[model samples]
Target chain A: MSPQRSEQLLLIPLRLAAMSAAVICFLIVALLVLESLPALNNIGWRLLSDANWRPTPAAADGAFRVTPMVVATLVITAGAVLLAAPLGLASALFCRFYASPSVAVVYRRLVELLAGIPGVIYGFWGLVVLVPLLGAWRPPGASLLAASLVLALMILPTVALISESAMRAVPQRYVRAAAALGLSRWGTIRSVILPSARRGILTAVILATGRAIGETLAVVMVVGNIVRFPSGLMEPVRALTGNIALEMGYASGDHRSALFFSGLVLTGLVMVLVLFANRLGHRGAISDA
Target chain B: MLDRVLTQPRAKCRKVTLPDRLAALLVWTVATLVAGMLLWIVLDLLRHGLPHLSIGFLLDAPRDAGRAGGIAPVLVATAMILIVSLAVAVPLGLATALLLSEYIRRGSRFAGFVRHALEVLAGVPSIVFGLFGNALFVRYFGMGYSVAAGGLTLACMVLPLFVRASEEALRSVPDDFRRAADALGLTRAAAIRSVLLPAALPGILVALVLSTGRALAEAAALLFTSGYVLRVPESLGDSGRTLAVHIYELAMNVPGGESQAYATGVVLLGALLLINLLTALLGRRYGAQVQGVRR
Candidate 1:
């Protein structure tokens, strides 16, 4: 065959593979929307407002409220981000600046190892250890506090690794210049290096927040999975991901659709967060260049 | 003379004061905290899990929510799924990567869209993928709750990772190799197969190991599509439980299931650590090869 003909033949397979990936994305979004439509039509927008989640009998045109679940999802994710941000940032700083070369390599490997462990393991660990620890100080064994702690652990690697990369990308010249001006090593890191790397760090935190928000197995294992307004860190709460995972199996009529609706909400939240982070990451990259 | 005067005061001030001591303390504290959390997780799993660890527990099947049962079936299932998923993913991923890096030019609109779509795929949560597997594999394909179904679903899950990694590896190959091949009247396909692929193998291997680690840990998607079963899988069509799914089922349903869950967790953790160590060893060997080539 001529070279041109062979090239054309290759394009056929390439096009086919690319098209397949696109179709997969479309199918995923379509299925999520289709499953969610019934609940969307039934509850209308009121699903966002009503706090109660009692599903009346199917014959009674059951009311399936989502307000408490939404609140719970936001609260748990926010709490996790709050817990993770400082520790992750500090670890990132230590890895980038304080650690010697060998220690830094070990630290990076540790983060990678942590990141690879399955979420389910974290959930199992949380159920065994974190829940009981929380229960001793509180009432129910499963609570938002337990969920948040597990989530914080789950997302720590994402936050630390991304932030570390960002911090490392800050120009060495900037730090050196700051120090040459009589600023101490700490001052250079604090006043100069951090400000320069702020965008990257922010992007990392946002991504970690997104991960925490959508986490399923770990939080489900510990968050009590109760659909109610969170009373405190000790009270059981249902997150959007946990709700879908727990109920999608047995749900029928509006209940199944409601679970899909939860998935839809979770996807929307993740898309927004991811897009925001990507934008920030792009700008950080440009600045670094 | 002026530079010396400017530098002398800075040196004198540095000798008298610990300017960055507080910041250093803060950084150390943060590192300690992260290290502490990781240690705690490992310690907690061992502390709770070790009591349940026994020969009988490793060999026998789960009996009840509370007591000792072996996880051999679940271990086998996890291994099968991991191997099956990687088997399906690696080739397809490498092909797509080759297409993107070697065949397509950098600025092609088609290439850009494909890249963006893969990023979107990567960002999509695993639960959504599980739901997709439910609709497509189980419902449409009539696969039911089989290892094949879960494996295929997970293959799609890791496809983007492989493609991205492979593309990156291919991109790192120098243009000189392609030019030299062209000078010898070699076709693009011949050059890519003989030269580019060899050079990119190490990076592609790293990506494969990473994806395999991910596949082994996944549970939520497998929960519905894999359909947890206590018995050993006799065939690809048979339903089986992974260690993660087993942990989830037992922990949620069984009273004092915590101990059993911990024991299973230790097995999973051990698998992950082993994978990491193996990857590190392989990566180091590959690193030396790349350096040798550079020299």
Candidate 2:
């Protein structure tokens, strides 16, 4: 074969690679839209806003409101993230300014290992252990509170890694400026460093939120699979993800389409967070450069 | 002014500074707590899960509706899915990364667009991937709920991670190797194939391990596309359940399956820990080698 031809052949794979992302994106959105159309056409916009999600075979009279699952998802996501951010930020701070280099390195590796563990294992552990610990608050032991704690653990790594990077990126000159004054170590971090790194911290927390909402298996195993809106953190609740996993096995027709619709909602919510994360994260990168 | 802000050691200033110190202490405690939590989870999993694991459990197919049987078939299914996903992701991911790092200029519109798409891909949840895989692989292609469908879905899920990591791997390859290759009259393809790729292999291997861990642990996307059929899969056409999905089914449905779930989780955790250790060793060696070459 001619050299030019060979190069062109090589370019085929390269071009395929370049275009694959776009192809995957279009395929996911298009497939979701097409598959989800049945639910939209049958139930209209109320599928999103209505909480009653009883999926009977009768298409006309079936209730497809998923408000409870939606709320549960939001509550779990917000609650878990609230718990994680402080812990993550603190860990990041300790590593950046306080820990010895040797200690920091090992701790960092531990965090990485934690993050790399499968989501299912987290679910498994929660189901076996964390849930039982919660039996005092909720009889069945599978409550939103347990799920949130597990979710918090699941997201701690992301928060720490991102926050650490952001903290590291703070100009050393600013640190010197703070130190040149009478300010102590704590005061500098509080007054000068954190404010400058505010955007990164927010982005980190948002990315964690994205993970919390998108998580399925862990939340599925612990949150009791109840469809009712959570009355408290101790109450059994079902997130949108748990709902789909619970019913996708036996669901047919409109019930199935409603599951697809749930998937779309999840995809939409995650995309928003991911998009913002990319935007903010890239700007942070540019600023660092 | 900076000194004024700092040197104001008056009572009010001291009170404000006290909160800062307290907050610092509070954060330190929280960080320590997080570390303690990690140790606790690992130890707890080992304590509860280690007892249930036996050689028979590793090799026997689940019995009595996943209550008494070992996870042999589940392991086999996981292995099959892993092979399928890695086969699809490794070569394609390398090429995509090559395209981004070598074939395309970084600041160009197309490159930026692809990067953004990758970020989106990375963050899109597994459940959505499940839904998409179900619609496209299981329904559109009429593949049914089988290993083929689940594998394809997972390939899509981890492809972004592979691309991003491989791109970094490729970029980390020193430019001098390419320059030397060009001086020897080697073409771009030959230079990359013979010189740069070898240098990037360790990093790429790290990427491979990480994505492999991802594929091994995925449950939701596979549940719909692969189905919950719990038997040894004879071919790509056969429906099979991965260990993750198996654990989910047993733990949630079977009455006495919690112990079994813990056993499977131990296996899963062990696999992950092994992969992370492998990556860390490679990462350190790779870092040192790169530094040596640069110097």
Candidate 3:
């Protein structure tokens, strides 16, 4: 065969393998949607409004209610982001401007290692450590407080890594220019470098938020998995992913379908967050280009 | 010139004094905080788990919470899952990477789509993968909550990471090697196998180790699919509990569970730290080879 023909032939198999990934993703979406539709049809929009979690009797045409879990997901995620964003950004800034190269590399590796530690470990740690610690302060340790702490730790690596990369990508010329214009080093970072990296940092926050929302094992271990509206930080609450994991095995009929519906909602949230992050990444790349 | 003269000396003075001190303080504070958190976590694990550590605990199956139960089964199961998942993921991931880096150009539409899709896949939650595995592997394939199903599901979860890392490693290999191999009348596949694959092995090893560490710690995806059986896996299809899942079950279901859970966690953490250190050492060794080739 000619060289060009051989190259073309090779490309065929490559395309086929790449296409397999797309097909898998499509299958995931389709399965989630199809399984969820039964519950969606039954619950209608009431699923979002009703905080009550009790599934009605089969004769009553009852559907699985998700409002409480949805609220818990949002509340815990927001609480986590609230805690992680500032600390992550601050750590990124410190790494960019403060640490020596050796120290920075060590710190970066630590962050990466922390990031790579599995969610199950985090859940285990939270259950043993954070929950009891919180219980002393409150009633039970397994509450939003414990969940938020674990979530914050879980998402910290995402935020820190992305923000650090963004900070590094900020042109040194901008900092030099600011210094030349009489701005202090910290002032330059605050006014110039951070603003330049804002888009990337925001993208990281979104990605971290998505992670916080979709987390299961860690949250489930610590969050108490109570299906109720969260009244306080110490109150145990159920989240969508946790609910799905906890009950997916025993769920029958509408309950099972409702669990799938929760997955669908979680997927939608993840897709949106990922889309925003992707757009930000592209914009950053284009601007750099 | 006068402005420059006055400003330069004053700026130098200020840098040596207030701003320098403040910057140093700020940096040290942040660094200390991060270090503190890491140390606290490690110390906590050791503190809680050390009391439960015994030869018997490492040898026997778990019993009642207060009684001495060993984590030998959990440790063995975790190892099996890691090996099985790596076996499944490494080849497919490397092949995908080879296709992307060597066989395709950077700006190809197909490459871009695959790259984006992989990112999306990487971002999908573990729970979603668990649901998929429960539906597809455990239920449809009749794996029945065995190590095989969990390992296969985790292979899917880590495949994106491997592909992206391997592609990166391949991309970092110099084009001169390929050109030289081509000049020697080597086939494309031969060049890749002889030159590129060897060059990228360290990076590929790094990716594999990282994925293995992740698989060892995975619990969410294994929750339903692995079925948390407290027994040694006799085969790939046997139900078993990983260290992570075992910890979860013990902590949640058993009384005085925290002690055993902590002990299992310590073992897992120790394994992870060792893997990370080994990966770093391997990366350094292979990194020198790639650097030497470049020079």
Give the share of true interchain contacts found in each model: 0.49, 0.64, 0.37
Candidate 1, superposed: residue stretches over 4 Å from native = A49-51, A56-60, A282-289, B1-19, B50-58
Evaluated at residue B154, the lDDT of candidate 1 is 88
User: Which candidate tops lDDT?
Assistant: 2
lDDT of 3 by residue, B56-124 (tens): 888887776423579888888887887878887887788788888987787898788887777777777
Candidate with maximal DockQ: 2
Best-fitting candidate, measured by TM-score?
2
Worst 10 residues of 1 chain B by lDDT: B1-10
User: Which parts of model 3 have CA positions greater than 4 angstroms off?
Assistant: A1-12, A49-51, A56-63, A282-289, B1-28, B54-56, B65-67
Q: For each candidate, what's the DockQ? A: 0.47, 0.50, 0.42
Candidate with the larger TM-score of 2 and 3: 2
Candidates 1 and 2 compared: the better one by lDDT is 2
Would you list the C-alpha lDDT of every candidate in the order shown?
0.78, 0.83, 0.78
Instruction: Going through the candidates in order, state the TM-score of chain A alone for each one.
Output: 0.93, 0.92, 0.92
Q: Write one digit per residue (lDDT tens) for candidate 1, span A157-222.
A: 888888777876777677657656786556666688789889988888888888888789999999
**lDDT of each residue in A90-164, candidate 3, tens digit only:** 777666666666777888787777776778778877887778888998878899988998999888878888887
- Alpha carbon RMSD to native, model 3: 4.0
